[model samples]
Every structure is written in C-alpha cells, then in structure tokens.
Target chain A: MAEPLLSIEELVVDYGRIRALKGISLSVGQGELVAVIGSNGAGKTTMMKTISGLLKPTSGRVMFDGKPLTGVPAHRVVKLGVAQVPEGRRVFAQQTVRDNLVLGAFLRLRSGQKREVAEDTERMFSIFPRLRERQDQLAGTLSGGEQQMLAIARALLSRPKLLLLDEPSMGLAPVIIDEVFALIERLKAARDTTLLLVEQLAFRALEVADRAYVIEQGSIKLAGSAKELLANPSVQQAYLGAAATH
Target chain B: MQTLQLLISGVAQGMIYALVAFGYNITFATSKTLNFSLGNFLMLGGVVGFILYMTHNWPFFAALAAVVLVGMVGGAVLLKVAVEPSLNQRSAYGWILATLAVGIVLRNAAEVFWSTDDFKFRSPLGDSPWRFFGEPQPDGSMSGGLGVYPQEVLIIFVSLAIVAAVELFKRRTVFGKAVVAVSEDKDTASLMGIDQKFVILFSFMLSTAIATVGGVLVAPITLVSATMGTVLGVKAYSASIIGGLESGFGVVVGGLFLGVSESLTARFVSTGYKDVPGFVVLVLLLLFKPSGLFGRAAIRKV
Candidate 1:
C-alpha cells in the first residue's frame, strides 16, 4: 500500500511507572476507517491522546503526514490537519452552538479563510440539522446525543486530514450510539478523511470498520479485516457475548 | 444633598475598585492564577504618571500613554518572571506566593528608588471641586449643594469605559473568544488549535495595564506613594471576590456596594469604621454563597 496517512512505531506510554501502552504499533491508510476496539483500561484512549499530542510517550514514534509528532503540543498538532473528538464529547459548554462551530474553524479563520470557514460552518449545520435549529442555544443545554453530534461537527469543521475519535459511544443511550455510528458510516462512505477510532463497544465498531485492532492489557491482541475478525472464534467469544468457558 | 454628594464620591471610589477588581478577574479566568502584584502595578502607574505629568511637565495624554506602556511591559515581565515558573512546577499554590512576592518586591523597589513619603498628584482636569447649585459669596467662595470633583467624574466615566470595552472585546472578537475557550477547557481548546499559553500571557498584560491606568486615574483623589496600592489592591481583590470572580457585572455591583457603604458609614459612623461594614458584609455573603453575587456554583463531575 502507498504510505499510510498515520503510522505508529512501537509506541510506549506510562502513567508514572504504570505502563498503559506497551510497544503498540498501528496504522491508518489514506481514506480508510480503522478501529481500535477494547475494554476499559486497554490503553486505547492513551494511544489516541499520544497521537493527538496531548500526552508524551516515554518511547516510540507517531508519524503523521510525513512528520514526527512526538513532543509537539496538542495546540500545534491540530494545526497540522489532525483533530480528535475527545472522549465524553467535550464541547465548549458555555458558548453558543454557533460559537462552538466557529471555534472549530479557529486556525482557518486566523489565516484569512473566513469565507471558507463560514461556508464550512453552514455545511456542518446542514449535516446536523439539529445544530442549525439550536445554533444560538448554549451547548451545555444540549442532550447527550446532541452534544456528541456537536462535538463531531466541531472537529469536522477543522477539515482534518486524519481524525482520531476516542469513544464516540461513551455515556450515550443505545439509540444515540446507533445515530453516532450511522454518522460515522456516512463519513466512511464519503471517503475523503482517514479515521482512527477507539471504542469499547467492540461489535458496534467492528460492524462499520474496514479493519479492526482488538487491544487487551495495553497491547494489540488481534488485528485483521473486520469480516475476518467477526468470523474469528476468540473475538466472538471474548467481545460478542458468545457462550464460552474462560 | 449631602447624601447625593456622598453617593457620587462613593460611586467614583467604588468604580476604581471595580476596575482593579476587573484586572484580577481577567488573569484568573485565563490562567486559574491571580496576579497578586496587580495593586503595585497600579502604584507604578501613579508614580510614573506623577513624575511625567507633574514633575517633568509632559502633556497629560502623553503621560497617560507612557503609563499604559509601562503597565503592559510590567505585566508581560510579571507573567514571565512570576507566573510561568510556578505553573511549570508541581505546587498548586506556587503562583500565589510568587505573585505576592513580586508585589512585595515592587513596593520595596518603589520605596527605595522613589520617596517613601506621600506626594500630591495634580489632576489633568484640575483639582478644584465643580460646584453645582452654588451661590457665590462675598469672599468668592461658592458655598453650595452637591459639590463634585472633576477628577471623580473622570474616574467614574473612565473606569466604566474600560470595563465595558473589555467585556465587549471578550464577547465580540474571535481572539477574545479564544481566551474564553482556554478558560473553559484548555485541553479541549487545544484540539481546536487555540494556544492557551499565549492566551494566559495576553490576559496578564491586559489585567495589569488596566490596574496601572486605574492608579493614574485615582492618584489625584488619593496620594502617590509606595503604600498606595497595598490597601487598594486588597480592597479591589475583595471587590472581585464579592462580585463573583467569573461575572463582569458582579464586580461593578460589589465595588459600588462597598464604595457607597463605606461613604455612608464614614459620614454617619466613625471614619475608622468605614472598612468594617463592607468586610462584615463580605464575610456574611460568602458564608451563604461562596461563589459571590452573579457567580455560578461550580459543579464537579464525579
């Protein structure tokens, strides 16, 4: 395959001597959707954070669009076409929905792309019509699913080349999770941006992903095409609620 | 008439406190740290203004411009020397002590380099009271109702203008909104490519600059001295706390309440008891609503 959009090489991260991601490696090719599905404490979020420049890895490399991203602060990381929808849908709660959308295009607006930014904001409103209806409403007043939609819209406004989505289904109702996943599938079908998603609902992620990595105890235990993994006995037994003896 | 005059005087004084309190709020919002040396920054402006405008006879506006310049530079230096280092360290209260130390150093430096004794600062608008509804006497004295100082009027107008301008900036401008974003959530804000460190630095600069201008404006009413900012700083800080550190309008109300209360108490009660009633109210108010008037109580996530 032509060089992947994002590549991680033997990435190791620690939380004060408690190793979270131990020598893990992964990659996402251009216009591909790759999912990392695992249970809690599997270092999936840690890996996402490291990729987005929020956490410093003790050892290893994160190469994005042919540049080493280690030690670059999170603020600079986003400017280089990498944006993450952090876990828990962390929107600017105090600001209006419109303001949140405007801020998503922050770097673009700064470099004299006001017209493009404004156009993109309208595009976001079109994609999520609920946002258009409540553009003037404070983001904090939105329901859990709406906040998640706003968060995705906010990140998408950056027009990122690579998007890291950490737990899109976190703390959402089952119906909202389905809606979020449907949006993800729509984005995947469009095929313009590469995505690296970390999710706890293994089956749900595997349902839409082209390929999936199953992580356990801070390491990738399985990696393969989604169809192959869905057929695998172990993946089904461990994550898909199949009856099996531990 | 006496009550009205007292109200005006109190309002002017209170506005100064509100302006300085606003300085405290700006820095605190961006960085979660207060510039304890803010009051001394005000003193620095006053002394500098006095030297240029009175002693050296520079044009009033030029002196004011120079004072503002000094304030900006001082604020930047303060952030670099006092705030950033503490933020880098592990200690939570390091910044508080660091800022307090900077304030002390500024006060001592002023005392040693300049005069320890107080000096009168002549107002650009003249020191004489503007008598309203007055009857001129045979001795050319206008003994009248509601006599007000031009300086006090200037103080009220200028302070309100500064507060309104800053509040508008935060609400209207993109860069200003970036500052607000950083205050709300620095980590999430970074995902939007907002440089929070730069925001913090900008806040410090703006806060100190406001305090310095306040010092220059207030010098005509009070005296210019090293000790000038000590009490004013404490009261401004108190005013900020009383108003709700997060709310812009709250500080104004807090300052006005304190100012009017002090003025009334000074006239009706003993002059020494002027500070007592305000402090007592602050203590009582905080006991019920720790967030201050207009402040929202923080709800922590479990």
Candidate 2:
C-alpha cells in the first residue's frame, strides 16, 4: 500500500478501433511476484506491452517507481528499470549466444560496465551451463527451453528493478515448461527483484505467484491471494486444466 | 599477361561497385530500406573531394577527411529528411520515392551549382601506371607488357580494408551487435534498451559515408560529373541484388564477377556490348536464386 513499485490506473489500450484493454488497474509491490493469468486474447500480452511502453494505453496511467511511464518509449522503459521478456522468446537469432548476452547488457555496457557485465554474463553461463558450452553457436540453434533461459538471462543482464515475463512457458515441452517455471521460482526465492508474470498457465502461475489476478475479456475478473484463488472452485473449473491452452 | 592485366582492372572496378553495394547492405540490414540515393552520396563525395584536393589545392588526406565528414553528414540528413518520415507513416513505397527524389535533386543541384561537364580527378598517387614487365621507352615510360594503374591498386586495397573493418566492427563490438539486434527485431531490440531509431539513423549515416568515400576513390578512374552516380548507382544496386543484399562477401563476389566479365567482354565480344553479360547473369541468377548467391532465405514465422 505504501507506493507500489508499479501501478496501473484504469489503463485502456486499443488495436486500431478495437479495444484491447478496456480499463485495467493493477499494482505490484517491491520484491513481489505477481501473476496475471488469462486465456489467449485476454489482453495479457497487451497489458505487459503497455506496462513496458511497447504500447501506449488510451486513457490511463502507468507509474513505475512513483514516476509516470505513460508515454515513454520501450527503449527508455528498459532504461527506467523495467524489462520485458516478450512472448515467443524473440532472441536475436543471427547472433551467437555470447553476443546475445552482451546485447542484453547493451545500455550498461555503454555506461562503462563492460567488466561488470562480463562477470554477470559468466554468472548467467554458470546458471545455464548449456549456454556456456554453446556460447559460440548462433542463438537460433538453441533449443526452445535454452532460448527461454537465454531470454530471461538477457533481460536479467539489464538489472531491471521490475521484470515482465510474458508467457515464459509458451511453445515449450511440458517438461521444459516445468523447468522454466522452476527457474522462475528460484528467481522468486532469490528475491533480488520484483516480477510480474503474464501467463496462460493459470495453475502453474498461481503456484509461483504470491498474489494473482484473473483477466478475461479485456478486464480483471478476479484479484486475490494465490492460495485463495487456487482454492476457489471457479478458478479451478475455468483454468486449472494444465494442458487446455497449450 | 593480358588476362592478368584485365583481371586486376576488373577487380578494382568491381571493388568500387562492391563498396557502394556494401553501403546499400548496411542500411538494408538495419532498417530494411535501401538508401536509393547512395550513388549520389558517392557523387557528393567525389565532387567535394575534387573541390578540396583538385580545385582548392588542399592536401589529399585533408580532402579525404573532409569528404568522409560530408558523407557522414549527408547520410544523417538523408535518414532524417527522406527515410524517417515515410517509415513513421508505415508507407513502404514512400521511402523509395523520397530517396529517389533526393538523388534527382542532388544531381540537378550539382549541374546548376557546379559544372555539368565531367572532370578528370588526378589521383594522389599520380597519373602513371605501374608496369610489371615492360621495355623502357625513350619517354622514360615502360612500353606495355602489363600496366596496372597505381590508382587501381589503391582502390582495391582501400575498398577491401573498408569492407573488412565494417564486418569486424559488426561482429566484435557491443554497439555493432545492437545494430544487428535491431535489424533482427526492432521491438525486441528496444526491450534490451537499444534505441532502434538511433540504430537506423546510424545505419543510414554509415551507409552514406561509405558511399561518399567510394565516390572519391572511384573518381580518379570514372571522372567526376554531376550525373556520374546515375548509371553507377544502378549497376551497384544490381551488384547488391546479385550478391545477396545482406551478405558482405556476396557483394564483393557479385562486384568482382560483374567487373571481370565486363573487362573480358569488352576485350573479346565488343566494347558496345560490355554491359550485356553482367545484366544477363543477374537476370539468370535471379531466376534461379532470388535471394542472391550467398543470401540466406529467411524462414518466415507467424
């Protein structure tokens, strides 16, 4: 309640004439892991994009660190300590794994954190050992799960105060999806950063989230503690079908 | 010996084309827009270089530096004036025409403000050819065994150096990787905090600067004229298409192929038909491999 790190007030975004987010409001406290779970076309990615400044809301406010982030460009948004791992693990496919990691720390590198970023990169390699072994290979050659790790690691390199993970389990095998969620859980336990995860995997998301919001038809349908939502029969009947959306 | 002489000449000529083609590649790689006025930027370089080094009697290196500055500035202006507006509107054809119009205006401006007549640009290395094996004549000149112009050698080395430097920069530097990232995905690039607009602007500047320096380098052989970029620009575009717009080595290969064939055709077939073979190859090549000889066909994602 004491000035959340990110707060959206009646955010409305549109795709041309079609309204994507009619009016949505959410808030995430410092060091909190908040999950927004919804079906496809439920305005989850749009909301993430709007928060990260990839999309501008029609008539709403996005405040980050108590500063207005309504119309800031996406590039500037990253500079303001918010990074989004966009849906589909859109890695720079043409470049090598190491190059991708270096690019992840692009702003910091320019600000003279080359050695620090390099040390952080070594840390990423340690966390995902496959990345170290395949650092010289083009990122496109990486497995979907590896690519997801790379995406998250790359976003982490920016050292964002708030991280937006849009469907981290998307397009991965069920086993791999579990691994990704486990990694997300590990990050949560570390508690070095705040995270807002937009996911179609409602049950998995709720399991990891400290708090959760259910969005449907461009609006927030439910907002409560993850335990309460998980216990709620309506939430289970609607979205606890683990394989339904995938 | 005649073949060898023709080969060097062809390669040198090809490098000029390759250099300009490389310019096209840089901007296209980053922004997916070809700087249509690249040749004119080259012309701008030549004209400026001529004024400084030839007419004003400035030192060659000083003139070269000035030409490079002008080229960089010209590139930035082209991006801001012609490229950005259309891109913002999301009109695909707008940039093509905008750049073309700028090129036309540039040509007309040169003709009106300067001379329309072609002027021979004296090479800093001087006018004489470097002979491999020749008889010394009474005029203290070697009589034709194989005569390679000093300018031709300079052109080959300098062009290769430029291409090599740029390729290395893209692979080795963080800023360079950011440019590549922007090219791959503009939106994703911004997520990494890369100002993609600045990357696009930088691509334009680098593209134009390279083209301009090319003008200065090529002028000694081609002559400086208001309309010099027109045909040369078309040919360079062809070279880019033939090589693969994205491949650095491909452009050089395409340029060299065009250059050698042109030289050989002029010697064997006819001077009037010299341009025929390269265009024929380009047509045939496109029919078989549309992306270009070295171009990778992108696997489309939904």
> Could you tell me the lDDT of residue B257 within candidate 2?
85
Docking verdict class for candidate 1? medium
Highest TM-score scorer: 2
Give the docking tier of candidate 2: medium
TM-score of each: 0.97, 0.98
The clash count for each model shown is 0, 0
What Cα-based lDDT does every candidate model obtain? Answer: 0.90, 0.91
**Which clashing pairs does model 2 show?**
none
A1-246: candidate 2 lDDT, tens digit per residue: 688999999999999999999899999999999999999999999999998888988999999998999999999999999988989989888888898899889999999998899899989989999999999988888889999999999999999999999999898999999889989999999998899999988988988999999999899999999999998889989998664454
lDDT for each residue of candidate 1 in B173-292, tens digit (9 for 90 to 100): 888788888989999999999998889889999999999999999999998999999999999888988999988899888898889899999999989999988899799878988789
Model 1, residue B11: displacement in angstroms?
1.0
Worst 10 residues of 1 chain B by lDDT: B293-302
Q: How well is candidate 1 docked (DockQ)?
A: 0.59
Give per-residue CA lDDT, model 2, range B1-302, as digits (tens): 99999899999989989999999999999889888998898899999999999999999999999999998888888888888898899897899999999999998999999989999999999888889788889998888799999999999999999999999998899898998899889999999999998998888888888998999999999999998888888889999989999898899888888888889899989989989999998999889998899999653221
Runs off by more than 4 Å, candidate 1 = A242-246, B136-142, B298-302
Candidate 2 positional error at A100, Å: 0.6
